[model samples]
Target: TLAPSAAPAASASPAPSTTASPAPTQATDPAAAAAAPPASVVAQYTALTCAPSDVRRSAASTDKAQDWIAACDRDGTTKYLLMPASVVGTDVKTASAGLQGGGGTTSINTGQWVVNVEFTGSGQGKFTRLTEQTIGKQVAIVLDGVVQSAPQTNERIAGTAQISGSFNQSDAEDLSNVLRYGALPLAFERSQAESISPTLGRDSLHGGLLAGGIGLLLVIAYSFLYYRAMGIVVVASLVVSGGIIYASVVLLGSAIGFTLTLAGIAGLIVSIGVTADSFVVYFERIKDEVQAGRTVRVAADRAWPAARRTMLAADTVSFLAAAVLYVLSIGSVRGFAFTLGLSTLSDVLIMFIFTRPLVALLVRRRLFSVSRFSGLSPKMIGGRAAAVPVATTRARLAKRPTPAGQKRES
Candidate 1:
């Protein structure tokens, strides 16, 4: 895999050509771009401007002795590199025949990022001869009419050669991938392209919204049926959470180009379950305290500490999964992950700032004491009926007749 730089350049190298004209340099370091204006005066690029060419032009040039062609450097600069335009040495029809592959790595000796390019058995001989002719001169590796790299030929290489320059990790990897896969990795034939009609797009949006609404209604119906009057808390919390999520989505769309697609609506529907689970956890905990003989008011407050921990744990896991998916995925999947994560966070806020306090307040009301209305009432939660106060029992004993004479002495 390691070949010393003694080989000559091939009459033509294995770099692939693009069908369209080459584009200007695409990648640049922000810091370098920022400092470029002041340094422009000292820097210079001398290659003459030349018209672009494709594989046909490159193959035609190979019959001639040499043709000077100018191509933009891949580096983040305005300079152009000049070289002989030919894909001659490699099989012209299949440009990759002479090349094996390439990759980016840190040189063990120099400790700098570099790209390693390997050649096929036949390409080795041709490359050796080309390098001999261009020794000490820069040989530009042309891909898509642009110069990927213009490495100075040092010596004759046998099978592999290293392209070394001032490169960051991303730059090195990009060059490596380009070499590994030809300029056009897959041959694509020309085809007609059309956009979906606006009416079709609108129908898709309506369908997604309708599905989400139906799911939400089912959850709300279940909450009302099971919790009765106490279900209002669940409904209120959801409303508040939905409001916050809506505002966030609108603000983010304006700020960061976030478009809510159908996949995102699916994510929102899934979040409904997550939010409902939080309510169920909290409500169940309160019922447990009520079943243990606590009043609705006492149970509401006492159950919170334990309920909060459970809710937090569940939301944390949910948020982490969403975050990981968002980071690892692309396209519409990312949209789903982002919405799920956002809703998870909103659930935490509603649980703490809204739901917990609301329950605490509501449990103190007379409405909550009514078994028929508040599903959290002791009898409703499968606990014993509410008993009279201990104070009232003591007063009744005091008021009893003095037949038991000892009671009057006090």
Candidate 2:
């Protein structure tokens, strides 16, 4: 019981009411009771509505909300995440396996995300832990903030790791550059895009071919005129070297999508001069030895070391130039540098393999030693030294019998 002005306490005893609602024990007005509930009760009710589990359940009903939650949950701690099956496709396993093995290294440094990856001892342990922790989760290899790979781990990995996707040589090289050097090593930015007409490229190619053909003709003519019979060997060596280079180009084009751009063609054209220079060096050295009174075979042998040194020196300069150009230049200039470097290497190979051997074989023959047709013949080489006479003075005098009287007086 309470005074009239004071609020009545809540009744301990449960009681039935005329209305269907629970009986109100307080002495407050029915309207006032309906208008407000106790603060504690209201707080409890609000908290139930805002529980973490309930919010998640509500979010699960909408696709966008679910995605938001999923993304938010990824803190790089989870080993793997589910991605669209279509994005990963069937080749995912194979590629992922390849990534587990170490691949070869390269020099081109684009610097996107090159990491020094190894499977040796400590590396193996780290990779194994990474694979275990990230199992069935996505580990993204990001380059320049773009996801280069978001590979889902199917199993724990151990030992060496290789990064594999649908990568071209350039892509692999670029990635390797990144892993080896770092993201900003190259510092490349898209400068500008200008449309190049194929018409100009075609015209340049045509002119280049024409010039190459004329140069080839001049070399062939000079070889035949100067080297005579031995010139055939020189021509043959050139043909073989050309065939090898052409086949290599075609194979590289097919296998690696290496394009024969105009600049590349120019490099090949320049290589022709390098190759010719090698031949000239060897030929001149041999002729010099022959002029120094050595037999043809001996001259060929004695001249080789000096000629080889000269050829190597010349090719070294060309190779160095090509390498520098490749390192310094970009775009089409790189193609030119690559081709020039390849040709210089081929020149060295041809000098050692075909040219030297063919000359050695040719000089070994009797006809080559004796005939004027052979450019290496001692008599034919500069006409400087006369051939040694076989007949003796006594034999000549006996044949003449110049005087029986002169003999008797003697």
Candidate 3:
């Protein structure tokens, strides 16, 4: 019985060896095993699961998924994703290539693309149609062969549709700027650039203010030295002009987003010079007339027209130059141009309103006209003939014979 058991065990051992040999043979044929269809592939073929039931449906029948995806890809990876219909709030049509539509020419440029779509009087209809048609379709917005966006329409849009994808804020801003500014009649080109840091700009403003203050002080000192008591008129005029300019700058800053840079400060300082020059011209003209033997009041009146003409001519040239520079330049140069123009305009306004009116008022005062300290007295006019003296009523009475009786009575 034991020998028979041993024979059976020996036969089982050969079976184990046969199984071990097949394992090695299979290990050597790994490439062949890998070439065989995977279990997952076999299962896929044999079993059929339900399709994804969660596909998002668009409100608009034409809203297609493919259009959105294309738009997203075109916009790059960083832009805010937005739907077109939401932005335009109107109906849009799917235009064929080179189709001219009602909105404008559907054109493509190197940096951007245009989608030309025709909108009905009820833009909603066109939007609905576009949304319905583009559903699940890759609708591309092409600009000069570069696709801006290709968004899949998820719903039928009742209004205008927008597809935004990977655009940066700058890109969106630039696009918006183009849309808004392109319709304007004016043309512009960059002519210069000067980058000024905030710190540097502040320092410049400080220095400019210091210089302007010194200049103003010198002007006031000279006015007092030369014009004496009447110099108050010059100071008052300057104050009024300064106030007007300050209010204007503040209001402009609020209204038009105007900024006051260092260059602008320079412009203001220069305007001070212009304002002073106006005063000097008027004063000198008045003095010359007085030296020619005219009364102060007469001289002031006579000098106005000539002074006005001269002021107009000078301001006109300054303003024109500023305008040209503003139109032709960019960046810091623009700041300079803006300041120059503003100063020129303020100069004109001050000359007309504050300076002329104040001077006219001063001339009407007897003290200003007669006092030597007022700088307008005829006696102040060097080498000029003196005013003729007339006898007073008192002097005439004293010379009369009745005056002796009045003296005895006193």
Top-scoring candidate (TM-score): 1
1 against 2, candidate with superior lDDT: 1
Q: What ranking emerges by lDDT with the best candidate at the front?
A: 1, 2, 3
Looking at model 2, how many pairs of residues clash? 16
For 104-167, candidate 3 gives per-residue lDDT tens digits of 2344423323232334455444345444444443333322212233344455555433433334
TM of each candidate vs. truth: 0.54, 0.47, 0.48
Q: At residue 120, what lDDT does model 1 achieve?
A: 57
- Weakest 10 consecutive residues, lDDT, candidate 3? 18-27
Instruction: List candidate 3 stretches off by more than 4 Å.
Output: 1-200, 383-410
Compose the digit string of candidate 1's lDDT tens values, residues 330-377. Answer: 999999999999999999999999998899888888888656668887
Quantify all predictions' global Cα lDDT against the true fold: 0.62, 0.55, 0.52
Candidate 3 deviation (Cα RMSD): 22.1
The candidate scoring highest on lDDT is 1
Quote model 1's TM-score: 0.54
Better of 1 and 3 by lDDT: 1
Model 2, residue 405: C-alpha shift (Å): 35
